[model samples]
Every structure is written in C-alpha cells, then in structure tokens.
Target: MNKKILISLATSAVLISSIYADTTSLGEITVTTATKTEKSIDGVTASVVVVTQEEIEKTGASTLDKILEKIPSINAQYARFPHPSSKSKASISLRGVGANGTLILIDGKRLSGETESPYEMTRITASMIERIEIVKGSMSTLYGSDAIGGVINIITKKIDKNETTIDIKYGSNGDGEAKNKNVNFITRAKVGTFKYKIYGNINDTTPYSISKSYSQVATNPSTGSAITTDAQHGVTGVSNVTYRDESTTKTIGTRFENDFSDNLKVGIDVNYFKENREGEYIGTAKYINSGTPILVKNTPVSSEDKNSRLDVSLDLEYFITEKLSLDTNIYRSYYKKRNYTNPINFTGPTNTKFSANVTIDGIESNLKYELNDLNFITSGIEYRKEKRESSAINPDPSSSEFITKVVKYKALFIQDEIVLNDTLNATIGARYDNISNADNKTTFQAGLVQKLGENTSLRANYAQGYRAPDIAELYVVSPSYKDGKRFGAEVIYGPKTTAYDLKPEESQTFELSLSNKYNDLSSQLTLFNTTVKDKIELVSYNDGTAAKYYTSENLDEVVIKGIEASFSYIFNDSFDLSLDATYLKTKDKSTGNELMYTPNISASIGANYQITKEFSSNLNFRYIGKQFTNSTNTTKANNYNLVDLGARYNINKHLQFYAGIDNIFDKKIEEELGTNVGRYFYTGIRVSF
Candidate 1:
C-alpha cells in the first residue's frame, strides 16, 4: 500500500475512536499568540506544542538540546562540549529551514543579544524554565523578524515563597556533570511587593580522546605538498589529541512587582551571569614520520566570559468599559558582555572577540474589545531602539577593528477572531513594520478551525512573513588570517553595501493539522509547506590561488514541505508508549533540486513501565536518516540508530535514584561531516531534593 493510504487509514481509525469517546476533558490552559490576551489553545487555528515542568522532568532531559532532539520536526547540532564561541549556542532548525529563520522569545521579550547569524544565541538555563511553547508555521503577523520558520517562547519560573530545590547530575565518557541550586522568595506584605529568585550552576568535564586514522591527503599540484590534513590510526608517526573542558555559570536575578492600583503594575528586574571555561589539549607524541618524533606537547588554556542585563518595566491595564480594555508596557534593558582568552594560538590563530555592549528601550500598547459573544478584535503598536558598540583587537593594534551600530524599529498590528458557530472559527491578522535600514513591509495571516467532534478537530493556516537583517549581520567588521599563517588582518566586510540596498527576506507558509484524543490515546499530525524569496546564503570567494573569503548574499528562492506525526497510548495503569515521526523534503526552486543536510525521514519510539509504585523503567529507540553536507550533495552521511534505557527508584519522598545510558548500541557513525565521527556511550545519575 502507498504511504498516503496508510496515513489515511490510521487517521480515520483514531478519529473514529475519538468521536465515540467524546467525554475526554478539554484543555483549559490559555495562549498569548492568537490573541493579545490569554486564549485557549483549542481555539487557536495553528499547530502548537507545550512542554510543561512535569513533562520536562519526566523526559529526563539533561540539556536543551536533548529535549529538542526528541521533537519530531526539530533538528539540532553541537560541535563539542564547552565550545569556545557560545556556551548556550545551539542551532534550532525547524522542518527543512535553517536555524536563523526561527524566532525565540524569553518571558514575552526578545533576547537581549540576538545576532543575525544562521544560528541563535540563547542562554536560558533549562532547569530554570517554567514552560516551553512551540508555535509551528509562519508568524510574521505576530513577530516582525525571524518568524519565517516558527516561534519558540520560553517562560521562566515565577517567584514562589513555598519551595526551594537543588539538583545535581554526573555522567561518564568525559561527559561533565552539573549542579543547580535555586530558591524563590516572595514577600507581599512589605513596603513594596518583593519577589526574588537566584540560581547557580556548575559544570565540569574530563578529557575525551579521539583516535587518528591514516588516510591519503589530497595533493596540491602546485606545491607537491598535501592540501589536506592526514590522520593515522593505530600506528606511530602521528599526533594523538585528547580534549578536556570545564565551565561554571552563575546567574542571580530578582524581580519586584508592585501593584500601585488595580489598574497599574510596575516591575523591576536585574540579572547577571558569570561564565568561566577552561580547555586542555594533550598529545602523546608529535611525530613527523617513523623515528622522527618531534616532541610531546600539552597545553591548558582558559577563558572567562561575563554578561549582565538589567530590565526596568512598567505595565498598566485599565478597563475602558465593561467590554473594552487597554494594556500598555514600557521597558529598558542595559546589557554588557566581555570575553577574555589566554595568550595561546588554537585553530592556528590567536582569536579573540571582546567587549560587546548594547542598550535597548521599547514600549508597546494594545487595545482589546469584545464585540459580542463570538467575536473580538485586538490592535497594538510597538517601538524599539537599540545602540551597540563593539571592538575586536588582534593584540597587534593595527589589526584591530571597531563597530558602532544604531537601529530603530516600529510596528503596528491588528488581529480578529470570529467564531462563526459552535463548530467553526476563523482568525485573520496583519502587521506592518518600518525599519531604519529599510522602508517598510506588511505581513498577513489567516487560519480556520473546524470541529469534527467533541474530541477531534481540524485546522489549517496560511501566513506571510518578512525578516530584516540583524545588527551583527548588517554592520559587523572583523579580521581573518590565512591558513595557519599569522598574516596580519584580512579585510572583513559587513552584509550591507549601501545601508538600504539589500531586500528583505520574505516567506509564505501553509499548514494543516489534525488532533484527536480517546480514553487512553492522544495523537496529532501536521503537514506544512513553506516558500521563501530572497533567501540569504553565504558565498565564498577564492582568488584562484591560496585563500578564500566568505560573505553573505541573497538567493533567488526556495521551498520546503514536511509532515510530522506523534502518537501516545496508555495501556492499563502501569505502562505507556509513544511514537513520533517526521519526513521533510526541501528544494531550491530556482535550481529545481533538493536542499542539503535535511533528512528525508527521522523517527523515535519510547516505552515506559512501572515496576512498582516507586520504581519505573524507560526505554527509547531513536533513528536518524542520512543527510548531505553540501548543496551539490557530493558527500553523504551514514544513518544510525541508538537506544537508551533507564530506571528510577525512589528511596523516599526527599530522594530518588536514576540512571540512563546514552548511545547504548555503541554505533560509530559519521554525522553530516565526512571526516568527523561521533560514537560514545554515557551513563548519568540525578539527585533531587
């Protein structure tokens, strides 16, 4: 049978079961995207996934990447532990789109240091989050930029006076561990309402070893020397490298919320983070050839990075009438960051990027009115201004570069939700943004939801989104050196040529979804299509001789379409099972070819059984399909499957014992990169109090 026929049969079976079991409870939790105020997710005509605190703990995820890896349509990658550039940096690719297209928000506010790279720079601690909400498809009508792929909003924990907790974890295979302690204290009867939360975390890792394998190097016809690096395996005349890294990050924050009256609220928040990381490189022997051992070298270098941000915000909510309300908020953020590296040449160059500071101020207001029992509308306007100063020094004075950037943006948006009947609804929204670099743009969205039964629903959405280049991409000035040679600074230019020359990236997305629930089963399936114009791509230029220079440019067009499905079934009282699958096919329409690094199929299966009231066991199987590294698809990656098994034994109410094995099959598989391979297994335990 065809795959489409199979999907239709499965969907029909689930919908039939759900229609018969119509007594299933409905979700009451509200969302903020579809409307200015809180509204039920069931009423929103879009695909959404919510990961709550309980779900986060139940999944036993150690980091943000681990949890995202489980999502059916989301993809992520990390270079290594304690990466030099960004500790919290992880690429968040949705469907077949790149990471740069996804928009991320923290506590309803944009990230302080959002840069315009194909990757994101988010640093929120996973343990400190109260919930994570994922909105799939285009959202330009809600957010101005980076909403071409999707939106992910992380809500932090609210201050609480009742409880405090501490968590510590340890693992194997040079996999470091982390200790997190958080306490929330709140006071309501004092001179002013005070709510404060403090968090401290420590992570440490041992050295990891990578064996070398001998291979033929691509020869350079001109020099008669090797053009590529060669590694030897299980032999002499080679360099055996072992890597060790450790990082400690501490964050302290407090929020004071004052209720001046029933219609006004004032809030002040301050947050600071101090991050220190160190890495060690060890070589058994640096040999040029047999009996030609040069020497054995070992070096340890460290860097300390710091970031601080203070936010002062005020909000006022007034009831204009019984059916109308006015909401307004104003905020200012002061940000600073610094990175200090030891005097060592790693990656063949003495690299450093230090002293980046920015100050931002923004204000927003919304007017909401209820026309009737089944209709409502919301209109809002927002304005923001940011000033940034940065400098990069090559330690040689003449090779240094400096940058100063100022940007201002303004937007006006309106949304309307109409409930045609008890079983039908439609929503329409539009937004217009005026950017300093560019004139202006308008994006729009429309969605419809139909109720098939009490426990089953169908939704479809279409949206148009626009994204402008960020400050980093528009005005960055840096220096680069030639291959392992400390030749002075090589000129590096920003993306902008004449300030307003580049066109804004625009996209259109269409999505259809079905949700169903039965007594012991719940499932959701989605199909999405996205087309982007003026897509940005990096282009590399070589002088036809020795070195290559890289810059960014706009592409003609691209289109991506994918399907995602998830199912969960509860069997009896002690067992449960879940299956999730995703299939994506992306192509560059201008070339009529598929895009690279976007797999065709990926899936996972999970099962859990309760051995006893206090003891439970979990098993998971994960599969990743093959992908390519280059647009031309000259190179290919091998697919691999991995298994994870774990158990939890509760000692008492105050303690628990848990251990899990990652990469249990010990499969040696190369990722998208042909030369780099990842294969390892680790076991970790977690303690909570």
Candidate 2:
C-alpha cells in the first residue's frame, strides 16, 4: 500500500488524532468529512442512510412523496410523462431496480433522465429539501450507471444560524397547499483573511391531486352491477388526490460560502425548477342506447405539462501540506420537458411532445492522509458526462411521426478508505463505464467495519455491479399507418461493432450489519443478499391493431433477500420513539416465481410528543405488504395500512405553526386496474423571518 506510503500513514493518523482530543463529533461528519464527525453508521464501508433535517421536521411529511412512503426499503413513482401516459409519470423506484437503477442527486449534482426511469429526470422542489442521503447497496463502486439501484443525494437548504420561513396548507380531497417563503439574513464582520456565507431558497406548490374519481355510481367488485366505472368519476378518491396527477413546483435557490485563509474554502451553488401539470380519466360501456341497451361511458383524458431545470455546483478545498489535502468538484445540469395529450377513447395517436432535453457534466478529485495511530488513507477520482434529446408529434390521419435517439454516457472512478485499527475498517472501490449503447465494464467494492464494545457494531460488505441499456431500452421505435413507414426503427444492432451487444446487467452483493447504542437508545440491523445477471424484463406482443408491443429482456437470473430494521427511543428530552422495518424475498431463478412489484413486507411506526416549549406532536403508521402486478404473477396488489398526524407550534423564534393529517384511516388502496386509491388529509402553517 504505497501511494506515497499511504500518504505518510494518513498524515500520522491526522497528527495522532489531532494531538489527542476532538472526538470529531457532528455525528462523525462523513459526507466526505469537513470538521463535524460522528461517522459510525456501522463504521461505514458504505451502506449509508441519513435522513436528517430533524428527520424532515419530525415527519410532518408534506411531500418527498410523504417521506418516501415511510421508507419500506424505498420505492417511489410519480409522473409528468411516461408510459401510455400513466397520467403523467413522476416516478421514483429503488428496490425493484426500476427508476433507472435509481440514482437521483441534487447538491451532489447529476439529475435528468426519463423515458420512464433511468434516473436522470429532474424537477426538484421538496421545499428545497434539507436532507436525504439514502445510499443502500450496490453503488457501482461509487456511482456509475445509475449506481445500479442506489444513491439518492438531495441535500439542499443551508443557512446555518440566522433563518426565515413560511408554509401553509389545506387538506381533504379538494386539497390545496402552499409553500412560499424561506429567508435567511446573517452577518459577521471580519477582514484580512476574510470569511463569508450567503444562502437562499423560495419554493411553491399549487397542483396536488394525482387521481381520486367519484361523482356517484358504485358496486362492481367483479360485476356486482351498478358499475358506472372510472371509480364513479371526478374528484372522488375520497379527498386527498391533491391535484390530479400532481404538478406545480417552482423553486429558486442560491448558496455561497468562502473563507480565504483557514486551509482555504470555497463553494457556489445554484438551482431552478418549474413545473405544471394536468390529468383526467373515466370509462364505462354497454352500447346500443338507441335500441335501449344503455350504460355509456367516456371521459377520456386531457393533458398538459411543462418542466424546466438548471443546476450548477462547484466546491473546492485545499490544505496542500500539513498532511496533504485536496478536493475538487464541478457540476452542470440543464433540462426541459413538455407534454400535451387529448384522448377521449381517441383510439391510438393524438399526442404531442415538443421537446425533451438533459445534459450533465461532472468532475471530482480527493486525497487525504493521516497515517499512524493504527492506519489511515483515502483516495478518489471521478468523471461523468451525459446527454439526451427528443422531439415528437402525432395527429393521426392513420399516423406516422418521428424524432428519436441521442443518448450518451462516460464514466471513470477510484476509491479507497482504509483505517485498520481501533476495531478495524476497510474499503475499496472501482468503476469504469463507457456507454453510448454498450462496450466496457468494470465495477467492484469491498468493505468491513467492526467495533464490538461501547454499545456494539459490526459490518461486512461485498459488491460487484453493472447496469446499462436505457435509451428506451436499446432504441425503441414504433410509428404506424400499419407499416407505410412512418416509424419502425427499433434497433439492437452491434455484434461486430457500433457498440451494442447489450448484455450489461450484473450484480453480486452480500451485506450484514448490526449496530446498537444505549442511553436513550438506538438500533439497527440489516441483512442483504442480491444476485442478478442480465436481469431486465418487459415483454408483450400483440400489435395487430389494439396495440401492445413492448420488448426488453435479459432476464436469466434474479434473487433479492433482505431484512432491514431501525429503531430509536429517546424517552426523555420531550419523548420520542421510532421504528422502521422491511422484509423482502424476491426470486425468479428461472421461474421459481415470486417477483413482480416485489413486496414481501414493509412497515413503519413513529411517535413523538413534547407538549411544552412551543408544543409538538406526531404519530405515524404505515405498512404495504402484498405485491405483484404482472409477470405471470397475475395481478395482485392489496395490503394497506396508513395513518398520520402531526402538530407543531412555536409562535415565537420568528413564528412557527404546522399541521398534518394524511390518509389517517381512509384506506382504499388498490393500485393498477381497480384503483380505489386514498389520501384524505392535509393541514399546514409555517413562518419565520
């Protein structure tokens, strides 16, 4: 291990742990460290999880998709466009490998990609999100190709010290909500070596309703009759659909940090987002009204959507000698999307998509040393580039249209973090990707962490991952006047060369963890085993007229075994309690069955109370077990439990008041096909200046 003697033994173990004291606490600051420290997430070897901002303000949950549907091993989906127009796709998926192998970032840059999930889709506005780190398994050796189902970054909102705020809401179906203010004003005088920081944020939301139909007509759980269809029709999921296919996120952001002398510091960040949306659906049939057959239905759907995004980030740190240090980063992103559709049983074709754009650029470098006191070392290098474009139009007249394909990607990586002592720690990383369509692969990872006292801790990890093939799954094309040649170029080409032998979907993971803390209490337990190879599925053929022609495959092997747990208790300091659980068992080792929406079990439980010093209250419960919505598993998605309530008041400290109630006891869940849906409450208030 000679990289200049592991940087002189990590600069003599950070000068013998900085000459004795400074336990490095800020909870072991390892978002790649900078002072603050607390580090032990089972001593890190990567398997991160940090959802702080006071746990999203103690889960008053106003969005971030209701705090990621209470974790349950993460799986989120939303829409603005995608699918057969699944009423505007705003998707996010984690465990089932959908959502583009899951990789979404902000604050750490990189965002924009969507042809129905390949993860670089952008439209950020979770009230300028303050925290969310979620790094679950397989990071493709530190992010490459959507990290193959991991990595979620999204940490905005910083103005440490001085602050300002405002939030408001209304709930129960007809629902309406708003987020309009957050201001920070701070100052400190000093000259010579200088110091400065500036922060900013402004966010808004007005469209919130993603389906809730009902204006009358029930009874039809399999022909009980009375069935009017479309679940009755219009604004009736029993309140709480919020805006029918949701949309309306406006955001403005700014950040600046500098300190010219203390080892040098620099930071600059910027962001912008705008979105608008619309949706509708209804159906029922029984022709021959003239002859007296009655029962006619048609409400089709009308749609409109727009999205814009821009982000820029640059950060640098240099300490040069004293032990040696250098860190650099630069990022760029730009995106645009649009959609318009009108269908009233329009029978194929009438859609419009004026433009879609995505661009990204990234750079990273890191080096640190502190050898001694057992051992120390750190290294890094990273690069990424991506581009995408699209255009479309189809107005029928028997149809024929065009505009497709322009995707690209490139990646490189390296990592190491070894400190073997005080109970052991080790980490290794590697990544190499070059994809325009295919060719090139290399991913690796190794981890270990152990410390069995003062509480408890133990960890292990091994990873080897790969994922590639998303340009609508190897270039998809379908435009017809029934083959008069308007479009029909679905190519997979490339066996001799032009890049495309496609096969690049591999995985191997094994994980085990157990962490414990006492005195106020804290707990964690994780177990994972993943094995995948060429696993990508989507097949359906029947393109005669009624349409339905899809293809994408590699499904040869699969296995996902999991168990995750989190527990917290702080019975003092105003009371607290928390619990999170997940159990998964997905298999399809060539048809051993069990693998659809992949939901073996899910759970959540939460509680918090503090009736004094500015009041506080919280309660939560969530569970979503059963799953399967296809793949010969034959449709099945039932298993529901939900309840939420929140309260917070602190009319001083610049004023504060909050309210919440979601789902509560209004369970009507049933996704896909029989949609009964649910979400019955919303309440809000917040102000600070």
Candidate 3:
C-alpha cells in the first residue's frame, strides 16, 4: 500500500480513539528536558514519552535498548549480542531520521563523548535508572546541537536511604540451544546530608548461527567425487559466521553527592565499562572451477574494548529577591576508550590496537524571574571546550595515522512563558550559538497550548533546529598510503575537506497534538512534519583519476511526516493494557523517494495481569513493518513480529523470581532494520533490602 493511504488510516485511528475519555487532570510526573526546568509534561508544547521506574520493572527487559523499542515513533537496531563491526552496534532513530540527528544525555549530561551518540546507549543499565524522558521535534532553542529529531535524557536513581539489590538471570535460545547469563549489584547509602550510589554488572553469552554450513566441498566434474582440502594443504573452509555474535561485558559505576546547604550542592559521577567479542572471519578466498568456494585462510578474531566517563559538577542557587533567583552550573567530563583486536590465524597471528581520549569542560548560569502573576522569564549562557586525541587509525592493513583536534563553542538562550488566562498559554524562545571555524547560527521556537475542557488540551508548535558536525565527521584524519614501493609516500585524507565550506544541518519542524486523561484511560495523538536542509552525508567522486575519493558534504534535503498514537487503560487495579503505534512517511526531496532505513509502520501492545497477591504475568507484542535498506530504495528489509511472555512471583518483601521468553514464536529476526535475536527464554531472581 502507498504511504498516503497508510497515513490517512493512522490519522483516522487517532481521531476515532479520542472520542471517549473522562474529565481528569494529567499525572503528577514532572519532566525537566522539555524546558530545561521542572515542568509537567502536559503543559509542554512538544511530544514527549516518560518511562517510569514502575513501568520499567514490569517489562522485565534486561537492556535499555530492548525496553525503549516499545515506545512510539522510536526505531533502533535490535541485536541480542554486540557485533564485531561498527555497523552492528546499537543505535536509536526517531521518526525516519538516522542516529546522527538525535541527541542522547545521561543525567542531563552528554554521554556520547567522541563516539556516535546513539551507540552509547549500551553503556547504561536500566536497573540503575529512575526514569527516562524522550522529547520529539526540534529543540535547538534550548540545546545547542544535534536536537533535530529530539533528545533522550536518562535520569539515574539517587540515594536517600541505605539499600542493596542483587539480580541474577540465565537465558537460552530455543530449548537451551545457546546459553547467556547476567548478574547485577546495586547499592545506595546516606550519611548525614551526603549520599552515594554505586552499581556493578557482568554479562556473558554464547554465539548462535543462522546457517549450519561449516565447510564447502569441491566436486569433480567427470568423476563426481568430493574433494576436501585441509589447512595443512594450503586450503581451508570458512566457518562460524551469521545470526548473532558473542560477547562478555563488565561494568562499574558510582555517584557521590553532598548537599552542603539549601543553596549549594556538588556531585561527581564515575563509570567504567568494558566488553570483549569473539568471532571467526567467514570470507571466501576464491570460487573454484567446480563452483565450490575455497578459503585460503580461516581465523578466529577477538576484540576487547574499554570505555570510561567521569563527571564533576557544582550547582549554586541564590535568591537576590523574592521573585528572582540565579542558578549556576559548572561541569567537566573526561572520556577515554581503547580497543584491541587479535586476529588469531591458524597459520599466522597478529594484533591491532587503537585508542582515543577526549575531554570536555563547560559552565552555565541561568536566571529565573517572575515578572508578575502572568509572565515568567528564563535565560542562560554556556561555554564549552572539547579536545580529542587518537593514537592511530588504520584504514588499510598497511597504513596508520595519528590525529588531534580541538574546538570551542559558546551559546546564549532566553525563553519566556506567558499565561494569558486560565485556558490559554504560550511560549517563545531563541538561542544563538558560535562554533570554531563554522557558521554562527540562531534558532527559535514558538508554541501555544489551549485547554479544550477539564481533561483535554491541544498544543501546536513551530521550531527551528541546528546541529554542528561531530568530531569524527568534521576532522578525523584517516590517511591512506599506497603499497610501499617508490621514494615518496602517497598519502590521502578524505571527508576532510578544504575545497568548499560545509553547512551545518538545519531543520524546521511543526507539530500539533491532542492529549486526554481520564480516570482509567490516557491517550495522546501527535501529528508532525519536519524538513531538513544541508544534511551532512558521506559522498564520493572521481578526482581526475581512475580512483574515487570520499568526503563529507551537505548533500540532500529531506522531509519527514508522521503521526504517533498511544493509549493506556486500567481495567481495575489488578490489570492494565497499553498500546502504541507510529506511521512515518519520509522522502528525499531531490528524488521524491522514501528515505533509506526508515520504517513506514511499527507498533507494540502489552498487557499485565495480576492473578493474585503473589503472582503476576506480562505479555508484549511487537510488529516492525517493511523498510528500505538503501538510499536509492533498491533493497527492502523483511517485516517481522515478536511475542514476549513473562511472569513474576513474590516470595515476601525481600525476595522475588521472574522469567520471560523473548521472541516466543521463534520468528526470524530482522537483519538490520528490525529485531535481530532468536527465541530465547530467561529466568531471574532478585533480592533487595
């Protein structure tokens, strides 16, 4: 079916569902990401999803990515285990945009470091989270960059009392075919006005393959006899590739804070995460005469990588007057990573290593003033500096290059909230940013909220977004050297351009939404459209020779239009049901074709039933629709559906046991754009005090 028809159907569904609801107020949860302050999500003029601790606990999902996949209009690559290549790493996409367009923060701080932001979600554990807030649409008026699609802010748990929690889980694929294990320990303590929180995690898993073929044998044309060659005879068969990769991970994190006074506070956060992956290269050396593929070398490869992040911040607030207050924030972060690859060939073994170090420091001050009973004002200024160093990058087997780069940014923003009367509210905000060696840009936003009744509200907003290129995209130097032969070295650095000035990614977004909250039911409907210009993309062209050179440039203009609907109903206090769905229509303006890697339809439905005071059950259904894999829309990804079932038994207040089967139907997992895990069963026990 065409996307237009699908869009119309989705719109009809949203309008149809909104007709029935009671007159009630919204929930009491306050979201800080929408306006950089504590404000109820119902009053905000943008689309946001808040996942509470209670909601997360009921899902029984081990990883953050697995649970986030249930949210409407959110897409991510789903893999049971981390893969060996960069492409296999987990990444989040909003609407139909790629990972680069969205920004991710941990505890209101940048967790992305020098790497791609979306992939960094792997380092966070859902067990340590208090809540997560996801805001959709352009937010450049508040945050400086990469707020085109939206932002995801993860708020970790804080220590208020003394407590310890331990959880253990074991899982297997399809009747104990492959085994996986996880263990986690979390603790929090309070001493006077000082508090501390810490967490530790360990994960290990075995590999699973979709294909059972271990080796390929050659056949004689005339005699029809099978020919087998061993490694000793200079020929080998490739094996151990496909489906999912295997890995082991260990993580440790801690946060320390002191409330010296009501007006001053300080905190520091430290985290160390490490993971190792094992796999065999399954490449064919040549196609033999009899059509059998032969491998000259078969080697098992192992990689170990480490990540560390440290944050120290101080906050001070003082009231100069009864209606005015000043807040100051100073923070600095140091992130480091190291990767080692061991290609252990049966014949020859060699190891490759690379490392990166990045440091960022920033400070901000905000002033809030209540002009009157009807108007409120907020303004802030920030300055940030970043430096990155890399040991070496080997684009080819024979070449390695070292790189170092530094950049600075300054930003100023101001926003006002106006209450004209009891039934109407409006907001206006703007920001200006200056970056080193790039264009200075200004972004703005305006929004309105109109109450339809005691239980319903309609919100409309228009926003402008901006994003500066990341360090890797702007200046990572990968010099390619030809084979060592002549007197001079032939060096090439690409995507590093000096020929033409590159424009930053810019976007304009408009959205209209309606939300209703009743005694037992809550529903939200949002319709949005976004247009992006100067989208940064990797491109290549022939440079007056037979060879092609690559560079990053501002290439295409894209338009993404979509609608999201969410519904939740409580059937008494013991049972509940929730469902959400998204329909997106993204097109490249230059070609009038759907953008690559974007799904047109995706949905999730979940139910929780309490059988008794001691036992409860939860079931979730997910459907991922078809998507185009290539930019030109030449290849299509298969659509898939998954069913997950779990149950929990409480053995008093201090002990509990829960188990679940992910992909219960043994459905074929999607290769890249959908679920990529097999049917797996897991059981776990938790102890807390």
Query: By TM-score, who's the top model here?
Result: 3
Return the candidate ranking by TM-score, descending: 3, 1, 2
Report, for all candidates in order, the number of backbone clashes: 5, 50, 0
Residue-level lDDT of model 2, residues 1-689, one tens digit each, is 22243234333433333332322221353453211122545567656777777778666655565576677778554321232334333456566665657766666566664554422222443445778887777787666666677777877665454555555544544233322222222232234444333333333334433444434333222222344444332323322232234445556556667777679888777666666655544322222322433222233445566867787888888888777677788888777777555543323234454346777777877666655554445556666666666543222211224444544556666555666777777777777777666667888888887766655567888888788766555554322111011111234221111222447688888888766555555666677888878777654444343233344567788888876766676788898887776677788888787766656777778888898989888888887777786677877777777777788888788767676666667676654522323555555665656
lDDT of 3 by residue, 6-120 (tens): 4564555446545654457777778989888778787788788899987777777666876787775778743211123333455677876667777787777765264455336
Off by over 4 Å in 3: 1-22, 77-84, 112-114, 175-179, 208-237, 242-245, 280-302, 316-322, 342-354, 391-401, 475-501, 539-551
Which order, best to worst by lDDT?
Answer: 3, 1, 2
Q: How do all models score by TM-score?
A: 0.80, 0.31, 0.85
RMSD of each: 6.8, 23.9, 6.8
Off by over 4 Å in 1: 1-26, 34-36, 77-89, 114-122, 159-161, 174-198, 203-245, 258-265, 279-322, 333-335, 340-350, 392-398, 475-501, 668-689
Residue 110 of model 3 has an lDDT of: 66
Native-to-model Cα distance after best TM-score fit, residue 509 in candidate 1, in Å: 0.8
Q: What is candidate 2's CA lDDT for residue 249?
A: 54
CA shift at 87, candidate 1, in angstroms?
11
**C-alpha RMSD (angstroms) for model 2:** 23.9
Cα miss at 226, model 1 (Å)?
13
Positional deviation of residue 175's Cα in model 3 after best superposition, in angstroms: 6.2
